[model samples]
Target: MLLLTCPWCGPRDETEYHYGGQAHVAYPANPAELSDEEWAEYLFFRDNPKGPFAERWVHSTGCRRWFNVVRDTVTYEVLAVYGPHDPRPELAAGDPR
Candidate 1:
């Protein structure tokens, strides 16, 4: 079982949250101006990193606010969780601070 540290709710089981995919992706200002290829990139393309990754998550059954989480894919360890406007720190292995 994965242990996730919610920015607002503290440590919780992974089952209490929902994965919202990769973070730091911004939507285009003018959707109508985007080419099909660009739109496809935004809608379908996703990065599946094997190591530390930054992702968006919702503490669905808890805080419910969308925040960022740095997690390890192999060990299922959460590194850090922060609000959308908060700056992220450099993640170190097994340090969920």
Candidate 2:
């Protein structure tokens, strides 16, 4: 099982957490001006990266708090775990978060 470090609760079994999908997505600043395709993209599209990625997770069995994690897509190597209030970590190349 993958081990995840919860900044507040310390390291715990991955089973204690819940993956919350891709993180740090921002809504369009001017949604009114976006074309139909652009609006659809924002609503339905998310990057499927092959390498490192940032994702949101919830410690459902622990703190029950949400946090961000940077991990490798292929290897599942967790590089960092930080709270929502913290600044984004230095991500692997091409990681938008």
The number of residue pairs in model 2 that clash at the backbone is: 0
Q: Please write out the lDDT profile of model 1 over residues 15-87, one tens digit for every residue.
A: 9999899887888889999999999998989889887788888999997988998887877667777887667
Best by lDDT: 2
TM-score to true structure, per model:
0.83, 0.80
Query: What would the C-alpha RMSD of candidate 1 be, to one decimal place?
Result: 3.5
Worst 10 residues of 1 by lDDT: 88-97
TM-score of 1: 0.83
Q: Runs in model 2 with CA error above 4 Å?
A: 91-97
